[model samples]
Target chain A: MSENTTYREAVKRAIHKAMKEDERVFLMGEDVGRYGGSYAVSMGFLEEFGSERIIDTPLCESGFTGAGIGAAVNGMRPIVEIMTINFSFLALDQIINSASKLLYMSGGQFNVPIVIRMATGGGNQLGAQHSHSLEGWYAHVPGLKVLTPATVQDAYDMVGLALDHPDPILIFENSNLYNTKGELDTNATPLPIGKAKIHREGKDLTLLTYGVNLLKALKAHERLAKEGIDVEVIDLRSLRPLDDEAIMASVKKTHRVMIVDEGWKSGSISAEIMARINEQAFYELDAPMVRVCSAEVPFPYAEHLERAAMPQVDEIVAMAHKVMEES
Target chain B: MSEFIMPSLGADMESAVLMEWKIKEGDKVKKGDIIAEVETSKGVIEIEIFEDGIVEKLLVEPETECKVGTPLAIIHSVSERINISPAAKKRAKELGVDLEKLASQTKGTINLSQVEATDEKTETKAPTTDGMRQAIARAMSKSNTEIPHYYLSTSINMTAALKWLEELNSQRPIGERILPAALLIHAIVLALKKVPQLNGFWQNDTQEIISEINPGIAIALRKGGLITPAILNTQEMNLNETMHSLDDLITRTRTGKLKGGEMTQQTITITNLGDLGIESVFGVIYPPQVAIVGIGNIMDVPWAENDMLCARKVVKVTLAGDHRATDGRIGAQFLDKLDKILQKPEELL
Candidate 1:
């Protein structure tokens, strides 16, 4: 029952556990039935559920994603996998326009209880087209809960929470964090979305970020700690309906903020976060808002180029220190 | 006759191009009349005539760039005027002090150092560690030396005020910033209008009181230390004008570019430590000003109204005045008027 698990393995275990608890739960995706999965996160699910449940389909993301929405509306909980978020663009019409809007647009007549999981973020040398962190983009759309689980406990707990919700949910898993191991307990329950968790408590500045950037913020926190700067790392697991009160409370204490996001600088989630802080806690601010986001360029093919395109730990630390020294 | 030195309009200004002259060489002009237009860091501002007299000579012409503190013109009074020595005029010109206005106001020969001291006080210096520490030293020394300041603390319910601000701000643009500071300024102006004695200065030399409501607002700069820039005739100005004036003062103060006229002649002062979460503070009265008001942070506290306890957002306003000119009853009445005005902000509009 107990075993050493990576974030990816923890997610796979949560999916299998949910499937065993309810016969109505099923898995469907391209190559998920026979090829296990692109990352092997759903390796043995095909043998367990068979063809009737472990459904496979052609390379039509919009079709399968729409099918998943339809099945969820009919009282069957469906787990849909779109190999990577880059391919989710082809199915964006189904996920954003259809699945995300069905509940609100129908005035509560219909509910889309589907969990769409996708591989996100860069670090696997997965070239320009294959690697990108689109969590901020998905988070921009309303009526869909977006979750980014960076730890093993969150990976285990988020699946049950998504299944229990009466609306469509999107979960982003970082490709480079697949083998990162952490502790998890069986007694862990579903966590409510729209609430931020303070993973590390420090007094200097609050680092607001989510998804793969959460790990980068944590790394920056460690480096700042060595310089005698205690940084408060806030894992904003949920993006929309943000926990603004929590963010403001932390900002009032620290008097400074640095937002991190793996998205373009303009009109990104980091911008929205900083705007909220400015509106609510401007008098408390000692310095203006600082943002560390992905460079405003298309991801390149080379390894060094890709790393430069994404937000790094050094940038976050430098921005935090700069703000601290200003006031 | 006294020499009129060119006013240093703004910080970082070494010289100015005399744009246009509103008065001719022999034109008789009164104080506060626009004599010329000069451009500064902010915008084109009309240079005012600081004394009443006939313009004797025009030292600088239009299109001519003159250094600050140089004599721009000369004026002669028809009636008996205070005698000003040529050495004093030279010294005043060097210090950028308007000798004619100083002689007219003092009704005696004016010391150049007093003008220099006044100018020194007006110039914005980046607050160094020693300056702030010295200010603290002077403040504590004065508190212990001069007037005995008795502290009286009480909180007023601000639930109504907070709701009013929210409703007013919803209809305003982002530029017309409405903050607690604006509300406090409005309330204090109304109170001082009712009790003009609180706005008077404690003149030690003649043992006389001069009443004027030149309300000064304390601005804490980004770097350190503090500066009080006064808004003349606060009671006469409307709320919009008050807000505009305050915005102009704060913007200039933060950028370290406050003009000479912006700093001189304050009759009363208001310092807000509310932003820093100070519950209440007793500010030392800046000499000549009889009263100084301190505003505290707004917080929710349980209050008993109609024999029932309910949470209300409340702020404490403390008034420290010169007992030589004002008593406890006058101070209490002023506070009551301020509280009433804050509760009914529409009257100020």
Candidate 2:
């Protein structure tokens, strides 16, 4: 059942499966149809599902994003593909005001079943404008299901599950993970939204992370294991509705937590996790909560500067050392 | 000056009576030396010093029932003192604050607000333990109400096992005699391996099988309540390791020196009433965990072998399991496997 595939190919298979299963489902974006995709996410969708299902729109994020909301309110499941998360800012009014509030503002008479997918995060020298990790910003807004699938199996399963969600869903895919190859289980089951997966079992400290940083934490955990410092690495598949039970259970065992996030440190998702840990498991902690987030800067252009700006495996290992040894 | 306070002997002990002081003022002592004997709810424990110093003053008198953190003596070392705020000193006097806690907070000066903040924690030590008892009560009551538990009992021949254990003990010293409880625990865990359904928690609408066979021994405290701390990974250990771990667990359980995570990750529980000479026991299931096993006193009984009557040593084993997690048939299979393992006692080692 294991099919070795790239992260981009897994996503394309999920989209391909979902569109074939339902006629109401379609993909709409700037370059998703004939131009293949900005990152080839919907590369062959126009040739297979036809141009009607593979909608190629103008270079306007807000316009197409609003159209997704309109189609969703009228009982069509349209998956909006924003080329990059940096450009999602241009569609803020559509995402926040219309898609998010349609069901509640209309007294539950209307519901938006729109799944918005975007290429997010740093690496690959995407520079400042194209490389951004703002999934945390969308997580702050209510009525939006924010999912960040970190594994190949999850990339194949998460999108199809999001299509059935009644409200809007925002799927954040890391740009760095597109070429990362992994074994995708053909019989992969859909993971429930808001639940986290423990990538490695350990007893020293929990490294909570999502998306691209999940790999970094796993790498650090492996090296830490060799040094006799057992660390638990958790990939938070869902960004919002933080799984407090999983977080607290790990913290209660380890009594320490180090969050690795690609987002900037200030007011990032890591801050939210720290606050939750404090509220729930403050006395259980043997040491202070620590985090290794991207350095507060616009995504850098140079290779060295970009690597320095974002979270690295070495930083995660160092943070784990601080949490375990500083006590 | 280093202050020695009344130590909380166990998680349940809020206070203890200072029975005797082994050292007097002007006497020098080293770390790890027994300095005093305090009578806790469990029993009298000889407390040890963690630092080297000269006894400067004996603040507490004998036969005084002091709450935990009440200063007993002051030991002066070669080091000097840091200036404590006057308000902090007054607050410490009023609250009888434990200065060791403050030392960890700041190595420099102690302040008034720190004492005020720490006072609430010390004041509610009793309630915190009561909170733990209440937590246990909640889980037990939840198990009782929600779970439909079925009890099963079986009598297994123990003649081969008792003879094997007696022969094995002949070679060991008097101080290292392996008790029958260790063999019972070994049999229980091996049987659990064959029937793993009884070793996991039924929670979150899922039946998760706990891989590690951690069996909690229910040790009744001398004070009043019972604390069940587990012997971790008994399946990975031999009969000697199991005997040593069980002995260590009991001593630490009574003295309140149990290791970290010892009481938390109990996959299953074992209650042995053989020591009390009880015929059989039916223990309530500790919630989260689905099963509780009981071992009774081994006695000589008349048995039929190949259509002939004969005398054989047998013991009653009872299992109370959550019907939601497992059935009566599974319980029978587990007991059947246990009976088979008892016949081959060498496998336990």
lDDT of 2 at A107: 99
Report lDDT (CA) for all predictions. Answer: 0.80, 0.87
Evaluate fnat for each of the predicted models and list the values in order: 0.00, 0.00
Positional deviation of B277 in candidate 2, in angstroms? 34
Docking class of 1: incorrect
Locate the minimum summed-lDDT window of 10 residues in model 2 chain B.
B122-131
- Candidate 2 positional error at B284, Å: 52
Among all candidates shown, the one with the greatest TM-score: 2
Candidate 1 regions off by >4 Å?
A: A1-4, B1-349
DockQ of each: 0.01, 0.01
Task: Give a tens-digit lDDT track for model 1, residues A145-243.
Answer: 888887888888888888988899998888777788888775755567778899899887888988778888989999999999989999888887688
Give per-residue lDDT, candidate 2, residue A279: 90
Q: After superposition, how far is residue B317 of candidate 2 from its true place, in Å?
A: 50
- What is candidate 2's CA lDDT for residue B87? 45
To one decimal, what is the Cα RMSD in angstroms of model 1 from the true structure? 23.2
* Candidate 2 residue-wise lDDT, B1-349, digit = tens: 7788888788988999999999999788898889999998788999998888778899999999999999999887635455455446656778898766565445455655567667866564422355457877987898899888999999999999989999989989987888889988988989999999999898977788999999989887665567789999987888888899999999988777888788898999999888788888898899888999999999888998899999999899999998989999999999999999999998777
